[model samples]
Target: MFKSKEVEIPLRRSELISPTGIGALTTNSDGINLMPGALDMWFDNADIMENEFEIYEERLSKIFNVESFRLPPDYRAPFNKYQQAEKNLNIRIPMVRFPNWYYCSSCKTMSKEVSSRKDSILTCSHCKNNYARLIQVPLIVACEKGHLDDFPWNEWVHESLGPRCKGPLKLISTGGATLSSMKVKCTSCSGERSLRGLTTKDSEHLYDHLSKEGYYKCTGRKPWFGDRIQNEECSCIPQPILKNASNAYFSEVLNAIYLPPNRDAKIQKILDLLALPNIMENIELLKKTAPIPLIGTVLKTNFTSLSDIDNALLEDGIAKIINSEDKTENNENAVLLNLKIEEYDLLASNEKIESDFLVVQPEYDKDGNTLLHQKYGISKINLIPKLRETRVLYGFSRLNPPLPLSTNRKEIIENGKSKLFIKPQKFKWLPAYKVQGEGIYIEFDDNLLSEWESSIRNSSRVSKLNERLNNARQEGIGIKADVSPRYVMLHTLAHLFIQEIVLSCGYSSSSLKERIYVGPKENENMNGFLIYTSSGDSEGTMGGLVRLGEISSIESILEKAISKANWCSSDPVCNEIGMDFGQGRDFLNGAACHNCAYVSEISCEELNKYLDRGFVNIYDATDDFKSFFNYVETR
Candidate 1:
C-alpha cells in the first residue's frame, strides 16, 4: 500500500545530467529521496517540445553518431522576469519517489508511498496524536547491472515465520552506532531480525550473511522509469547500500572540446547541412540515386538556396563523406586519438582561431625572458580566451564503473554500449550541456620528453607500475588507457599544477579541470595538457585562469608546483608505500597521496589513477636521474 504526493527540487541545468541525472538519487530540503525520471518522461512535457533546447557540436555529433543533443529545460518560477515566466509554462524535470519505505519518527511505523502532490510530507496515522513526520529509510538495494529497489523489510522481519505471514513492520534502534543495534520487527507476529552484516561484503553471495536460504535477488526494478514502466528481467543478486553512497551511481559522461571546422567556409556549411538528422538518415537513398548532384539538390531543398559556388562546395563535401564511408571502419581508440591530434595541432601552432575555439600566446614585457622554456625545458604556452566544452550523459553503472567491452581504451562509448536511452527506438538524442570558459594550454618539448622517457622506461620503478597497469587491464578493471612514464609525469604535474593554481587564481581546485594528451603512437605523438575553468557560472570566465598563463605568472606557478612535488606531508610513508606496494584505488598510484598530488575527482580525467610524483620529483638520492625536473635546482 502506498500514497502519492508532489515535491519540487531546484537544480541547475548542468546538474541534470550529472549528480542528479536519471537513475541517480537526490534528497530535497525535507529529506525525501527523489530520482529524476527517464528521458522519455522529460520529453512528455508540452513546454519542452515547444521551446528550443537543442545544442550542436559537430565533432561530438560524429563521434557519438547522434544528430544533436538537448539541454535540460531550466525551470523558471511564475513570478520571474523571464519570458517563459509570463506564460506560466512550468517547465521542470520530472522526478519520481525512491526508497519507497519510510518510517514514523514517533511510532516507528514503516510504510511505503509514492509522490503525487505538492505537499509531500507523510504524517504518522498510527500515533495517538497523529503529529509525527515520516522519515525515509536510508537503505536501498542495488545490483551491478544498475537495477535499484527498496530493501526487503517485510521479508527480513518475518524470516523465522513463513512467507504467508503478513504484518505491519517497525524499525527500532537500540541506541548504538552499529547495524547490530538496529532491528526490524513484525508488530503482528513479534518476529524480528537484527540488521547485522546486512551491509557487509565478505560473503560469497550478496546478502547471504542475512539468510542461509539466499532469498534476496534483484527485482529488476527501475524506479526512475515511473510506475507504468514494467520491471525488466534481471538475475543479479542485489546488495544493501546506503541511499547516498558513492558507489550507488557512476555516471558515464563523454566529454569533448569544441574544435572549429578545419575546412573551407562553404565546404563546412555543406558538411553541416549533410549532418542534419533528416538528411543523414536518408543518405543511403541519395547516394543510390546520384551521390553528389542529389545531395546538392537535397541540401538546397532543406536550406532553401544554393548558388553555383555552393553546389561546388556541396560536391566536395559529399565526395569526402563517400570516401570516408568506403574506408575501413576505425575502432573507438583510433577515432578518439584522431580527435586529440586535431586539437593538439591547433594548440601547438599557437595561432589565434576566430571561432568558438580561440588560442593566442600571452603578451609579455620586453625585459621578461623565456624562463619556462630555458629552465624547465617547456616548449610552448598558449592562452585560450574562448573555449566551449560539450558533456553528454550517455549511461551509468552501479557497484562498479562501466567497463569497456573490448580491449580498446574508451571503447565503452563505441557502438552505443553505454547509451542513455534503454529503448533506442524511442529517443535519438542524448542529454548534454555546453559550458564556455577560458584555459591555459601547455606543451612540453617533444625531444625533451622522448629523451627522458627512453632513459627511464626500463628502470625497475617505472616497469613495476607498467606491470600493475597491464594486470589491471587484463582483469577488466576500468583503467582504460595504457600508462606510459610520459603520461604519469604529465598527469602528476597536472594535479600539482591545479593545486597551486587554486591558491593564486580565484577559482577553487574543483572549478578547474585537466585534459591530458600523451599519445604513445608515432604519428599521434602528443605531449601537452590543458587546464581550463569548467564552472557553469561567471566565476569560470572572469580571466583568472587565462591570466595565469602569462609569462610573469606561469613561471612562478610551474616552479611552485614542481618544488612542492618533491615532498609530501605524509612524506616517507607515502613515498615508501607507493614504491613498494603502490596506493590509491586498485594500487594504481605510486608516490602520490591526498597530502600532495590528489585533486577533486571531477578535475582529473583519469579519475586520479596512474599518478606517481616520483616521476616528477627526485624522491630518492639514487634515483635523481628518474626525475623529469632534476635540473630545476641547478637552474
Candidate 2:
C-alpha cells in the first residue's frame, strides 16, 4: 500500500527533470518508475480523486508552466552574472560579460590592472613596473544576475560601471530594454564599440577580453609609450573584470568538485568507496531516523527496522573486517577480499530501490565477532546503451523553457557534447534530499537530521585543514598559532582517502603491517595494522596510521594521484581507457608519469610489462607499505 500527504515547506523545490524524450523516465530490473503518482500525493492532500484533484492539477499546472520546475524565491545575488531570478525560472537575458576600459588623468596610458574580486583596489603592472603607487577604479562589473535578460546590448557598446562595483546601482544595467538595436555612446569616452555579446557565440570570451583590451581614447598628438604593441595608447573609458591574484590556481579548484555521482567510473568510485566503519556508522545513525527497506537470508524479507540493522551491526561478524585492518606493515596492503562485476552491481543499484538480490550472507570475523559485508560491483558489462538512463535533477527553477544546453541541432543527437555550463549556475539553490515518489513520507526524525548534519560538519574538517595548510603557505598569518586543528584535519582526510581506496576503488592494502591501535587488538592479521575498537566504540582497522614514519611521504602519493586525476578528468577519449593494473612503478616522483601509473591497459595482460600490476605484488618483507600511511599526529 502507498499514500502521500501535503506539507508546507519553507519554499518550493526544483530540478532538471528529464523531458519526454528517449532518455526520460526509465526503469531497470530494480523497480518501476515511481515518480508521477508518488510525487502527486506528497504535494497534494485534498480528495485525490475528487474536487481536490482538480485543485491539485491547477496548482501543478501553474508550477509546471516552465518545464515543471518549482522553486522558492532567491535573494542572494550570484557571484557570476548568469545566476538570477528564482530557482524555477529559466531566463536568459541578452547582455555582456566583458571588461570596459577607463583612463586615468595621471597615467595617460591605457594600462590599468582591473581587480577580479568584488572587493579590492585596481592596480597596473606597467605603472607598477615604474612608480608602483597608482590608484585604480572599477568601471564595469561582470554582474551575475538571473540569466542576462532584456536590453539591445548588440547595438551599442562601452557603458561605464557607475560608482563602486555594487549592484542595484544606477549604472546602465540591462534593467532598461529597447525593442530595436540602439547605439549608445560611452558616457566617459564618447567612443562607441560594437556590442556583439547579445547575438554572438563569442560574447563570453569578448566580455572577459574587456579587462585586457580596454576601451581608450587616443590623444593623436604623438606616439608615446614603452610597449611594443600598436594601438596600446588610449584615454576615454570604463574597465573590465580584473585579473585576480590567484587566477593561476582557480581552474584547479573548479576542477576538483566535478565528479558526477551518476556517470564517470572515477567519480562513481569516489562516492561508492566507503570504509566499513564509515558505512556502518552512517547506517546505524540513519536507522534511528527513518523506515529503511531491507532483506535477510536467514531472516525474513521485510522492510528493515532499526532492530534489524542493529542485529546485523552488533550480532553479525564485523570484527573480522576490523581485524583485517590489524596487519603489520610487512604483511599489510593485502587484499581482504575480491568480487567480480555481477556482485558489485547488486549494491550499486540498491539506493532508490528495494530488492532481495543484493543482501549479504552473514559471517563471523576473525575475532569471533559478528559482521555482515555489503558490496556492490558496478561494471561496464552492464551498460545498456539502448536503455536510456533517466536523468534526475535537483535544485533548479526558472520561468523560461528549461531546454537542455544545446544551441545546435547536432548536439541534441550527442548530448554527451553540449555547451559547457558552470555549476552553482547561481547560488539560487542549496541541496536537500527528497524521495521522488509517494510511499510512506519518511520524514527525518529531528534527532537524526541533527546527527547527520553533525557528520557533514565533521566530514568537512578535512577541507578546513587543507585551507589552513594553504593559509600557512602564505606568510601573512601570525606565527605560533595553534596548528592542532590543521593536523586533525589532515589525519581525518587521510582516513577518508583510505576509505576511498577501499570502498570507492575497491583496492584494499589492509594486510601490509600489524600493530597496536588506540585500543587492544583481540585478533591479529598477517599485516601489521591493528584490529580493534576504541573506547568510543569506534570499531575500525587502524592499518598503518599509528606513526608519521610509515608511508614515508603523503605528499608524493597525493601528487601522483592528482596527475592521473587531471588526465582522466580533462581528456575526452579517456572513457575508452581500460583499467589494466600491470607492473607497479614508484608512484612517488614529483612528476608521476601517467604512462607509468598502471601496469597495462588490459587488466589480464602480462603483469610485469608495466608496474602496479596485479601480479608481482610488492609483498615486501620491509615496512614500505606500512610506512606510507602511518600518519599519526600527537597532541
Candidate 3:
C-alpha cells in the first residue's frame, strides 16, 4: 500500500508525507500489502541535507509552511538542478525504504531480513506455515549519540556465547504483564534468559546481566548505514529501545518566514525576470547595454526603453539577483532569526509600506479609536498584507531529543549526517517552497507582561516547566531550557485564540497556524503571537482572517477566548490539579484539556504541550495570583 501511494500522490500533494509521517502508518502484520489509497513517501535525508556546504545543521534543511506563492510556477521547485530532478520536481515525494526484518504474528516465527517486494506474505521457515502474517519489527535499539539498530535477542539468550556466535533463537512469552515474563531462548546452546529489567529507566543500565559485566555494551549498530561502521568506532553505549517509543525519533525541522531585502516593484520585476536561468546568465551584458531587444521580450512589457531606469537601481537589482542563487549565503542562522526583527521594524514604519517579498498595513487609521490596548492590554495589531515562508527537514534524532542549534547540537547533527551519507559531499541544493498570505500579529504590552510574570504564583508556574526540562535533560534528551512563564502564557493564549477564531476566520482550525515570539530577556524584548493560514491554493484563505483583525472583531475574539478558558468541561478536577504532578509525567499543563484549550495537532508547534488555562484565566474563584486576564475582567 505504501509503494502504491508513492506512485499515486501528485506533485503538489507530495508534501503530505515528505518530511514527517513516512513510517507512521500501515496495514497490520502486512508490511507489503496494498490498502487501495494508502500513501507512504519520504525524502532522502542526505538528499535533503545536500547543498554547497555539508552543514545540514547550519542550513539547507527545515519544515516549510507554504501558504501563498510569490515566485512563478517554474521557480517554485527549489531543487531544480538536482541529479534526481524528476523525483524532486515532478512527483516531489520519494518512496520510503522500510526495514527488511519482519515477524510472523500467528506462528511466532521470524524471517531473515528481506529485500524483494513481489510477494506480501512469506511462509514461516520454522512453522512451515504458508501465507503467514508478517509485521515489520517494531523494536529498535539506539544510543544518545544517534546510532540505531535491531534488538540483540541472540546476545541476550546466549550470554555464554561471544558476540560473534550465530546461534538459532526463539522468542517466548508467558502472557504476563512485565517484560520479565517474556523470554528469549537459544535453541542451539539451550541457553535462555528473561527480558526482565531490560527496559531500564536510566541509560546507564542498558542491559541487565547476571554476570559481573553488569550491563551489555553497545555494538555500535547503525542500521541506517547498513550493518557496519566504516570509518570510526562509536564511543557511546547503545540502549535497547522500542521502535514505537516516543523518544525513539524526533525530527528537527527549521522554519523561517520569508523576508525580502527591498520592496521596489520594478526591481522585483527585474529579479523575477532574471530568475529564469536563460536570462540570468546574460544579466551582466544586459545591464551594460540598455535598450536591448532581448530585455523587452523577456519582460513582455509595453514600456519601450531601459535607458530611463536608474543605473544605481540596476546595480542593486543585479546584486539581489546574484544573492538569490542561494538565499542562505550570509550567516544562515542570522538570516533565520533576524527576519522577525526585520518584520517588526517594518511594521513600526510608515503605513502601506511594501518590500520585495513583504508588505504591511495597520488595521486601523493612524491613532484611531481602538479598545485592544485599552481593554485587553494588547499593545499593537498590524495586518500582514503579504508574507512568504520557506521550510525544509535536514536531520533528525532518536532515543533522545536534540539540543538547539545554538548548543552542542552542531556536533551531533554533523555526526548524524556523516552516518547517513557515503561520501558526505554537498549536492546542488535542498528542497524548498514559498507561499504568499495575509494575517494578523498581536503584540502584548511589555510592562504589563513584566508585571504579571513577577508574581510569586507565576514563579511557581515557571518552575513546573523547568522541572519537565530537567527531566528530559536527565534522560539525555538534550532539550533546551527556553521555556519560561512568558513562553507558556503566549503559547496558551495562541491556542485559545485559534480555537475562538476558527468560526470567524472561515478556515478549519487545522488550517490556521500560530507563531509565538518571546525573547529571553527584556533587552531581547519580544512578546507577541501571530495566527495565520497558509496553503498551496492561489488566493490563500479568502481574506477572512485579515478581516477579523478589525479593532471591534479582535476585541470580541480575545474576550471570548479568555472567558472560555475559565472553565473546561473537565474542570474542578482539571482546575484543582497540582502544577508539578499530573499527565505527561512532568505536569507540563494545568486546567487545559481537549475539551477547552486543545485544538487539532497540526495547529500546534509544541505538539499541544506547555499550555495551562490557569495562566490566562481564573482557575479557582478566590485565586488572586493565578490569572493575568483577571486584570481585564475586573475592569
- lDDT winner: 1
Clashes of each: 5, 89, 14
Ranking by TM-score: 1, 3, 2
Tens digit of per-residue lDDT, candidate 2, span 219-265: 22111111121332333222222212111001000000011223333
Cα lDDT of model 3 by residue, 1-635, tens digit? 12222212222332422223222212333344111111111233333322221222122343122222111112135454564544224323332223454566666644555332435454456665554556555555677665555566666666632555565565667897556676766666777777766667742244545334456556565444433334246666677655556766555544566545544456776666556666565665554565434444443442334445544344445555543443553343434444444445444333455563444555476554355666777887777756655544334566655455544445544554454343344432233345456667888888877777775344555566567667666865444346767677788899989988888877888777777777632133678887777552575446788788777788789889988888888777775663646443244566677787777755666656778787787556443365677655454
As a whole number from 0 to 100, the lDDT of residue 143 in candidate 1 is 89
For residue 434, what is the lDDT in candidate 1? 85
Judging by lDDT, tell me the better candidate of 1 and 2. Answer: 1
**Quick one: ranking by lDDT, best first?**
1, 3, 2
lDDT of each: 0.75, 0.22, 0.55
**Which window of 10 residues has the lowest lDDT sum in candidate 3?**
33-42
* Candidate 2 Cα outliers beyond 4 Å, as residue runs: 1-190, 194-310, 313-635
Candidates in order: C-alpha RMSD to true structure:
8.0, 23.6, 11.1
